[model samples]
Target: MTLAVCGAVSACADTSNTPASQRGFFGGIGAAVSGSDERRAAGLEQSATDAERKKQQLEARLGAANADAARTQVQVQAAEQRLAAVRSDLQRQKERLAALRAGSPSGSSAEEAARLQKELDALERERRAAQDASTAVTTATLRNLEERTRAIGVALDRLGAV
Candidate 1:
């Protein structure tokens, strides 16, 4: 009977087996770990999303600045071309006026004097308008460049790049 009892007790002490109830605790720990890992993953994903949004906004502003620069260049070129044409026209007008003054009497007739004066005044006005246009184009370009430079500088400062 003692020998039989010893064999039965050895059989009950199986080294490779665990109770089923303790498995629940390990499962709960695994679930908690998974939940914490999911929270960390979500946080990382949100950070990446925010970074991407900022990059897109910067790109959009940069593109707008480049486009504005191109438009300003075109406008400045057009203004320059118009100024050249106006200069040529002014030269011809001056020559005509000089010829008219030369041919007229020393004490000119009232009507002749008035007509000549009117022509001169019209030419002067047109020249001034052309000059004004040229100045405006130059000023506009400079201001636009300055604004863009300042904006970029501020952005760089925010990024600690400057």
Candidate 2:
């Protein structure tokens, strides 16, 4: 009887010909659990790869922007320098006109004063044009740079959150 009982137990335990699910209640649980874990791991890996690609793209854009900003800065500086030179020339013309008017009250002196006054007027116009150009360069370039920088900052922030 003991031998018969042992045979019955061995038969029940022998699962070589049984499908995994038919072997027992927990027979296929490992495969199911491991499959889900593998899928989750693959999903996480994909997300990481996407994030890294985005970061590299953003960095490239930032490098280009920085180079553009540097160029714009140089342009602004040149514009400012030109404006300053125009202003200096205008001041000198004004002083010369004042001196000519103050020197002699004769007819020839009056003619010379008028000529200087015309020259001064032309210089004033030149100064105004230079100032306007400088202002335009500063406004447009700086505003564009500011917008680009803000966009980059936002992108970086989003990447960090991810």
Candidate 3:
């Protein structure tokens, strides 16, 4: 009777075949729970990787845009300087023309002076055309740079929100 009772108790407490890791309270529950946890962790990791990649790409584009803007600024400055010089030269030529007109010369010399005046006028017109073109180009470039900067700023704002 005692042997029979011991056998019954031992059979009821059967844990010898169970793996060590699965021998705790609610141990079998880990199999289902661990699968979900692993999937969640993997998803979070992938999201982090994607966000980082996007951030790096945005930063690269911003850097390139800033460099382009800097170069454009330098070019605009150079154009402005050239335009200023051309205008200064035109003013000086105007002053020389005025002085020549005031001091009337003899017949042949007057003809020579007239030819010189015509050449100076043509040069002035060419310089004015060049200045106008340079100004237009610089204005357009600056406007483009400004718009690009605004776009980059908006992109950064969107990225930060993400």
TM-score of each: 0.52, 0.50, 0.53
Q: How accurate is candidate 2 locally (lDDT)?
A: 0.58
Which pairs clash in model 3? Answer: none
Give candidate 3 regions above 4 Å deviation. Answer: 1-34, 106-162
Candidate 1 TM-score versus the reference: 0.52
Per-residue CA lDDT of model 1 for 1-162, tens digit only, reads 965654554444432233333435444344343354456568779999999999999999999999999988888787777556555654554565455555553443435545545654664565566566663656554344334434433432332321
Clashes of each: 0, 0, 0
Error of 2 at 35 (Å): 3.3
Instruction: Sort by TM-score, best first.
Output: 3, 1, 2
Number of the top-ranking candidate, with TM-score as the measure: 3
| Candidate 1 ranges beyond 4 A from true positions | 1-34, 105-162
lDDT, residue 74, model 2: 88
Candidate 1 vs. truth: CA RMSD?
19.9
lDDT of each: 0.54, 0.58, 0.57
- Better model by TM-score, 2 or 3? 3
**What are the runs in model 2 whose C-alpha is more than 4 Å off?**
1-34, 103-135, 138-162
